[model samples]
Target: MRLSNLIPSIPANVVACLEVQGIRTDTDLLFSTTTFDIYKRLPAGTATLEELTEYTTIAAEIGAAPGMSGHELLLLENTYGDVQLRTGNAELDGLLRGLDGRWIIELSGDKGSGKSTVALNLLINHLASNLEDTALWIDTTCDFSPERATQFLDATQTLPSTLERLQVSLAFDIDTIQGILETLSRPNDPRARPRFLVIDTITPLLGPLLSAVSAQGHAIMTDFMRQLQTFAQASGTAVFVINNSSRKGRDTPERKPALGPSFALLTDTTLWLEAKNDNNTEDSTEDNTVHTMQILKSRSAPIGGCCTFRIHGNVICPT
Candidate 1:
């Protein structure tokens, strides 16, 4: 459980800082501290978000930490006030407790699995519910539609004002995505920061790079994830990243999410959405398609928890 042995590639400065703080082993980090606690112990301005994230990732991988007890976790939640952005779906909300601002939420699915629809619903819901709060939507796939946003708000009659608060940015490449994230990291006005951030299908934007040259792609993705972690932590902004799923063969047990373990490990929650066949029953007549969302991995909730829902009009509701 030595920190150096567990993550050999850990930055030298981070290792030195950990040693100086007497945190030579994984248990030293786990028993009496949180990642932030460790970060505070590091030399001022020497620890980067990426380094701390890598440390925690190794901790999880090596099972050095058993996680916080219920009491401690509950105390933390109480301090944070349990504030979250609602998904506009009651059942989904009940399962997820809403999109939490303290962690990243990753949604992975194949094309036509209602990922974008759900993201848009959350954006519209947040803008409608909180008039002063705004949202930033980074569309990499060019699938975001203003018309759909307007349609979602038509029922609530808050389209005009909600649209004003919803900021849209198109990032066609990795550089653009990185630049946008950087801009968010250093907001001109703290009050103008968005309540939540969305990147629809981050895989599509980074997939080609990984396919062409994996090492360079992984480096870029790692930096992107680090920037995202920093931005979310600093701003307390709820981040929702949509990803594509790798197709599975008939013999494969299940489909896997793209971007490999590094990206997967970066997220706090990973939800996999798969389209279900039409049952053709009385309830089935209400919607065109039903989606089964599996809680593949979660740090706060029980893993393997799942729910079924359908997209009716523009809103996602449990079936």
Candidate 2:
């Protein structure tokens, strides 16, 4: 049903603004992010907060009517539902429980810990399994190596076009990421919805905002996380964020995610990586280096599970 159908109930100007945002049908309004977010994007006088909330509520009810799955309602054919992503290494998959479901996961560690390698492995393996599926990589720190990704795809022996299905974007700030999330939230978007989403090294984007004197930083961080969660839940996109580790205190050995506890609490799981051998050694090759992945927290698996793996060429081998 078109937004114009509800014109008498909803303000005409409000519908016009929503249409400007590409919300033409009831499903579009229903799947778009929260009412407050939409309100903020609209012209100042277009819609009040209460008005948007009410309008969205109406859209939701209509969209949720009996016998209508979200995919059916939105006319989004062939959309992927909850899925278990694998890295093709049996031991690692067993350790991660196949990295199942649509949830937010964090992969964090010091440099050379093999976080990006493992993440890229996941993306390659998932895309290779089904050429029709797509994934997203948000390169916040400009660390996404296209050459490395190509090498991984070549190792899998999949067609060259498999790499084409992985959508990559360089977004170094909160606003850019927010815009990306909003675009993914739109039901009418032209690009295929990604089954997996990665934000590599979130530290650079969020690290500077966290300060001793400002609560606003925390609020902004929280909002960004919430928006990510909203997108994950709404779209069934398995989200992975690459994070960096930091010392818990001034002089202690205890380590925590650099984004702190607030960010940790928002994610469904967290995995910490550590390089057992220095891959930087002139004598060491990728085959000889070992990395350990430790699950610090999880909702689907045990909290202390650990797996050891090595990067040989572009493939992850369980050691």
lDDT of 2 by residue, 128-162 (tens): 88777789999987878888887776777778888
Model 1 poorest ten-residue lDDT run: 74-83
Q: Estimate candidate 2's alpha-carbon lDDT, on a 0 to 1 scale.
A: 0.79
Candidate 2's displacement at residue 231, Å, is 0.7
The best candidate by TM-score is: 2
Off by over 4 Å in 1: 1-83, 157-159, 211-214, 249-253, 279-287
Q: Encode model 1's per-residue lDDT on 80-191: one tens digit a residue.
A: 3323757766778777863466578898988877788887887788767777777899988788888777777775566577688888898887667666654554443433
RMSDs, each prediction? 11.1, 7.2
The reply for model 2, stretches above 4 Å from the true place, is: 1-79, 188-191, 278-283, 286-288
